[model samples]
Structure formats: structure tokens, C-alpha cells
Target: MLLTDTHTHQYYETDPIKREELMQRCLDNGISRLFLPNVDSASIELVMSQVKVYPQYCFAMLGLHPCDVKENWQDELNTINAAIPQHKIYAIGEIGIDLYWDKTTLDNQVKAFKTQINWAKKLKLPIVIHCRDAFEEVYKVLLEEQDEDLRGIFHCFTGTLEQAQKVIELGFYLGIGGVVTYKNSGLDKIVQQIDLKHIVLETDSPYLTPVPYRGKKNESSYLLYVAEKVADLHQTSVENVAAITTENSKIVFGV
Candidate 1:
């Protein structure tokens, strides 16, 4: 089976010596596809450059991250828009409310999210949302903007069954990642109850590495561990889990 890591940040090549090696390892381990989500204006060039280096294996998503929202959020969105034509952005992504870190920027985060949502609607593209400790807040905005044309993935989804049902109702898929493998993670329970059709697999690599490698730096190669956990939760085979989740990803991102 060709495992696809629907979300990862292979672009963060801070360590040159390790970057190429890790990518090769991922390839050898069957982690063939990667979708890189852009944070903001400053890293667009870097992210796109990384995508260019491995065009066939890596895909890109363009959007202003919730944390990147600030006083000049509009200018940053403008910057992302200006460069969209140069590359094929699979989705408008990694965008949503993040109240866990800084509450002071809540207003700006909401504004930026809504603005990007509008852009996704106008462009006829799916979205990749990064919501952290702001479920109700994110749901509020999503409900207001959601329509038949709006579709996306709730990247790194860590919510209850009710929330999952709500997002599915809004025509969005849940992005299940490394967090589900954690011994105490509530996501395992959530996934066991929800159907696989509403889910997609991701690593959020260089971040949420699964168990066995938890607390260590994550890589796209570790996506298999996440998939294994999901398969176990659903009491299904890994190949079935991968096939269904990969199809769910293509449905949302139109990849």
C-alpha cells in the first residue's frame, strides 16, 4: 500500500544534514505523499521552495495560520494570494482559531480565519483548519460561513463525538494524527465511536510523533504508526484504514 501523509511540515529543514535523509527514510518506509501547509507570509517562499524540490512527492497549501494573525493580517493574506498563481496550492489551510496560546490575538485570529474562509469560497478550494483549545470559537465561525461550496479538513482534530458530528454535518473531514496514539489521549475514544469515512490521516510531523517515538522529533515516516493506531481503534486492517483515509483526503483536497 502507498501510504500518504496528508499533512506534514517537511519544509522545516532547519537541519540540512538530516532533511534529505529523513525524506529518503520516509520514502523507503512507504510514506510516499506529503501535503505541506503554509504558516504565513514569511515562510511561503521557504515552503514553496521545499515543494519545488520534490514537486511530485510533496503538495502545498496556502493560508495564514491563526497564530500568524495580527495587526497586518490582511497584508499577509494579500501576500499569499499574490503568489498563489505561481504554484498549485491544493487547499487553503492550517487556518483557524488558536486560543490555547494567546488570547489577546483572538479577535485578529477570527478575522484572519473568516477572511481566508472567504478566499477558499471564492477560489473553490478546500481548507485545512488548525484549531487548538478553541472548539466552540472555531465552530461559531465555521457555522457562519459554511455552505454547500465550503469543504475542508479539521487538521489535528481533538474534539468530542458531538463536535465530530457537527463538522461532518458541515461537510468537513477530521484530520487524525499522532496524538491519537498517546496513552491518555481522548482522541482514541472519539475515533472509536466515529466512522472512518469522516476521517483522514496526518502526522503534523516534526511535532506530534506517535507513541514509541513520542516526545521525540517526528518525521513523515512515523505516519505509519498513526495509521496503525487508527486501524486498531477501528478494528480494521491497516490497508483498509489507509485506503479509506486517503480517499477521504482526496475528496476534501481534491488531490
Candidate 2:
């Protein structure tokens, strides 16, 4: 069974030995395709380096993460934009409103979100969103910017069923991550109610690690845990989850 991690930061590990080990673990676990999203100007190189080594396994997405929307946010965007044409990118994201970290940057976050959304539209590429504690704020911008070309996945989606439905209505897929495996995250219940077609699996690795390995550093191989949990929730098998979600990833990333 081929599995896909629609969002991951596995490239953060620069050590050649550690990186190879990580990639091997993913392959051993049947996780073959991993889409890497860079958060800022600095991470673009890190994302590309992984793609360079494993062109067949890793794909790249460029964007200015909401948290990085500081005083020099525009300069960051300029750098990322300039890098876009130099390398092939499947999406424009990991971008959206993140009010949890700093509420003061709400204005800048919205501006950056809109700017990146426009970038995706112009390029005719999907966008991978990173919304946190700002559903209403993010959704408002999506509504304003909704169009035939505005499509992508809502990365790390841990919102309510209502929010999930709203996102689906916008022609975007829900990026289900390790949170779905948490006993009390309530994401499993929400996911159970949503059709698998509207969902895609992700680890957001080195971040939201799944249960049985929660509280530890996450990696792409752990995507099996997420796939297993999703299969259980959907009353299916891991192979089935792998197939459906991987296919969904193809639909989004066009690979």
C-alpha cells in the first residue's frame, strides 16, 4: 500500500545519516510521497534540499507562514516569491491566519494570507493552509477570495464538524494529521462523520506526533499510525485508507 503525507517538515533534519534513516523508515512503512511546505524565506532551502535528494519522494510548497508575519513580512514574501520560479512547487502554503501565537499580527496575517492566495490563483496551484485559533478570521478571507481557482487543503485541520463542512464547501480538502489519533482530540469523531474523499492524511512531522508515540519527535513513518487510526474511524483497513488518501493527495498536488 502506498501512503502519502500531504504535509510534513521532515527536511528540518539536515544530517545526511539521520535524513536517510528517516526516508528509509517512511519507505519501510509504505509512506512514499511526502509534500514539504516551507514556513519562511529561510526554510525554502531546507525544503528544496530534501526534494533535491529525494526528488521521487518529496514535493515542495512555498509560502510565508502566518507566525512569520512580523515587521519584515513583505521582505520575506519577496524572497519566497523570487524562489518560486527557480524551483517547481505543487502548492502555495502552509499559509493562513494564526491568532494563537500573536493576536496583534491579525491584520498582517490576513494581508499575507490574501497575498499568498493570489499567488496560488495566478499560478493555478493548490494552497495548503495552516489555520490556528483563527477559523473565523481565515474563513472570512477565504469567502472573500473564493473562486474557481482557489482550491487546496486545510493543513492540520482540528476544527469542529461545522468548520469542516464549511471548508469542504469551499472546494478544499481537510488535512487530517496525528491529532486524529489522540484519544480525546475529538477529531476522530469529526473525521468519522466526514467522507474520506474530503480528507487527506498528514503527519506535520516533527510537530503533531500521533499516539503510541505522542509527546515524542514525529516522523513520516508514524504516518502509519495516523492511517491506521483513520481506517479504524472509517471502519476500514489501513490499505484502504492509504489508497484513498494517497489518491486524494494526487488530486490536490496533481502528482
Candidate 3:
């Protein structure tokens, strides 16, 4: 079974030895493909370094994360925009409205979101969104910007069935992460109700670690546990889950 982690920050581990161990664990668990999304200008190098080491296993994406939309947000975008052409990127993201951390940056977050959406359109690439407690606000911008060219995954999606349908209608896939494994996350119900074609898998590693390891740090290797949980929810085999979700990742990343 070949598993894919559509969204992960495994590159954040700067220690070379630990990084290799992390990659080895992922490979051993059949988690072969990992897409890394950089949050700001500072993380660009880290993302690329991981991609460089495991070029065949890792993919890179660029964007300004909503939570990082501070006063110098413009400069951050400028740097990321300039860096885009220098490397090949599968998507422009981990970008979207994040009102959970600070509602005050909503305006800038929206503006940054739209800007990155345009970037994805222009580049003819998909986007990977990071919506947090601001689905309505993010959905509004997506509606305004909806078109044939706008397509991507709603990363870390934990919304209702209606919201999931809305996103699918817009030609975007729902990115299911470790949250689905949570006993009370409610995501498993929504995921079980939805078809696998409109869904993708992710770990958001170093963050939303899956069950049996929820309280500890997350890694791409743990994606196997998530695949198992999803398989259980959908009443399918882990191999089937891995196949469908990996194919979905290929569809989105075009890799």
C-alpha cells in the first residue's frame, strides 16, 4: 500500500539525523509521498531542503499562512511570489482564513488568501487551504473567486456534510487529516458520509497527530494509523484507502 500525506510540515525538523529517521519511518510505513507547505519566507528553505534530500518522495508548495499575516504581510508575499518561479511547486498553499489564532487579522487574511488564489490560478496549479474556525469567511472568498481555474484541497477540513458538499461543488477536494481519528472530532461521521473521490489524506504533521499517539508529536509515518482509521470508518481495507487517496493526491498535485 502506497500512502500519501497531502499536507505535512515534516521539514520543520531541521536536525539532519532526526529528519532522516523521520523519512525512514515514513518510507517503512509505505507513506512514500509527502507534500510540504511553507508558511512564510523563513520556512521556504526548510521546505526545499527536505524536497532536495528526498526529491522523489517530497513535493513543495509556497504560500503565506493566514496566521502569519502580520503588518509585514506584503513583504512576505513579495518574497514568496519571487521564489515561486525559482522552484517547481505543486500548489500554492496552506493558505486561507484562520480566525482561531487572532480574529483581528481577518481582513489581511482574506486579502492574502485572495492574492494566493490568484497566484495558483496564474500558475495553473492547485491550492491547499488551511481553514481554521473561519469557514464562512474563507468560503465567501472562494465563492467570489470561483472559476474553472480555481481548484485545490481544503486542508485539515473538519466541517459539516453541507460544507463538504459545497467545497466539492466548487471542484475542491476535502483534505482529511489526523483530526478524523479523534473520538469526538465529528469528522469521521462526515467523512464516512462522503465519497472517497472528493477526499484526500493528510497528517499536518508536527501538529494534529492521530490516535494511539494523539498526545505526542506527529509525523508522516503516523499516516498509516490515519489510513487505518479511515478504512475503519469507510468499512474498507487500508490498502484501498491508500490507493484511492494516493490517486487523489496525484490528481491534485499532478505528480
Least accurate 10 contiguous residues by lDDT in model 3: 193-202
TM-score, prediction 3: 0.99
For 140-239, candidate 2 gives per-residue lDDT tens digits of: 9999999999999999999999999999999999999999999889998999999999999999999999999999999999999999999998899999
User: Candidate 3: lDDT of 178?
Assistant: 93
Candidates sorted by TM-score, descending order?
Answer: 2, 3, 1
Q: Estimate each model's TM-score.
A: 0.96, 0.99, 0.99
Clash number for each model: 0, 0, 0
Cand. 1 TM to true fold: 0.96
Whole-model lDDT, model 1: 0.88
CA lDDT of every candidate? 0.88, 0.96, 0.94
Cα displacement (angstroms), candidate 1, residue 175, comes to 0.4
Q: How much does candidate 2 score in TM-score?
A: 0.99
Error of 1 at 94 (Å): 1.2
How do the residues 7-53 of candidate 1 rate in per-residue lDDT, one tens digit apiece?
A: 88878885666878888988887787899998998888877877877
Q: How many steric clashes does model 2 contain?
A: 0
Candidate 3, position 58, lDDT: 97
